[model samples]
Target: MECCREPSCRKRGRWRWRWRRQSGSGVNAEEEHGIKKIILIGTPNVGKSMLFHRLTGIYATISNYPGTTVEVFRGRGSFENQLFEVIDTPGMYSLLPLTEEERVTRALLLAEHPEVLIHVIDARNLEKMLSLTLQLLEAELPVILVVNMMDEAETLGIDIDLAQLEKDLGIPVVATAASKGWGIELLRKRIAEYVRKHGVRKGVG
Candidate 1:
């Protein structure tokens, strides 16, 4: 498993997200780091920060739709023997900029050029939340949908066919109960695999 530590491979997975550093490729270390960013974007109260904490193992400040992530939070997650910088952007409902926070989050997305954009959504609210997902896909960005709060959905008898959703969206979909630590390992695996599949060995600088 080139992506993970040998010992952790059993639990982590075989493939990993890798950012190549070649001296003559004109790609400096800082820009290479930029290529390693994993961003989380979605509407408010969808367990975005919970998923972020599970991925990064860091405590993030949570609120009830504060709507201003002007001061974003980031932490590192380790999988496949490599570390990924994960970010929690402010809540945004559409690609069209409306509020200041949405504009901030939108600008950051274009500026950073992240390796993977994980869109966290409440599994029970898939219909309303999916429009933003479609918009992200229309932008031709690499996006993975995280169907979070499955435990709650299950309690409410809400069933989501993840495989079908993935096939229909033409992107990766991972169901997670971030608060309960479900599907996190698989989430990590998918993140690594997505980066490896999409990223070409070239300069991001």
Candidate 2:
């Protein structure tokens, strides 16, 4: 019988899946209750590094691509009145590693098993950026999608329906102008919620 149609399989897997979701949430609370380690990820030049600095107040070297600097940075941030160890990873287009940096980025994602994985992307290029978002979900990472460069999107007459996007992805989607300090707090709150709801300490995924 097909897995979806199998009663016994559903009975066995449903609670296990629910329990895994709770595990992720628990990990978030664990951090609040004194846990650390969150990782930020995205494609190149999408503002992942900038967001890291904004959230952590520590600057990492930033530059343009094609002779651009692609390296990960580590920092710290607090949300929901709790501290966290935050890591900003190198830009990666996909998990099926293509470039050296992409391979490195994928390795980090697999090994770190971060409590929260923030996927920062260019809001103007949502169509293109979402490919990575889908891939993240495929990897079973606890991912939150951040649409960075909202200001630019507005200037270009590109309106992103964040609610609709969230519905499509079944994940929290936040629009941010990271450089201008917009949406950072809300982003923090959502991150905290996801962490509290999904982080393994809470018995979530």
On lDDT, the leading prediction is: 1
lDDT of each: 0.75, 0.72
User: What stretches of model 2 exceed 4 Å from their correct place?
Assistant: 1-34, 59-70, 201-205
Which digits, one per residue and each the tens of the lDDT, describe model 2 over residues 97-200? 89878776776676555778899999888899898889889877888899999999999999888999899899999989999999999999998898777754
Which model scores highest in TM-score? 1
Query: Which lDDT tens digits does candidate 1 get at residues 60-175?
Result: 33322223536777666767765576778888999898988788778767755677899999998999999999999999877999999999999999989899999999999999
Q: For model 1, what is the alpha-carbon lDDT of residue 88?
A: 88
Model 2's lDDT to the true fold? Answer: 0.72
In model 1, the runs with Cα more than 4 Å from the true position are 1-35, 59-69, 200-205
Q: What residue pairs are clashing in model 1?
A: 3-80, 4-80, 4-81
Give the lDDT of residue 98 in candidate 1.
95
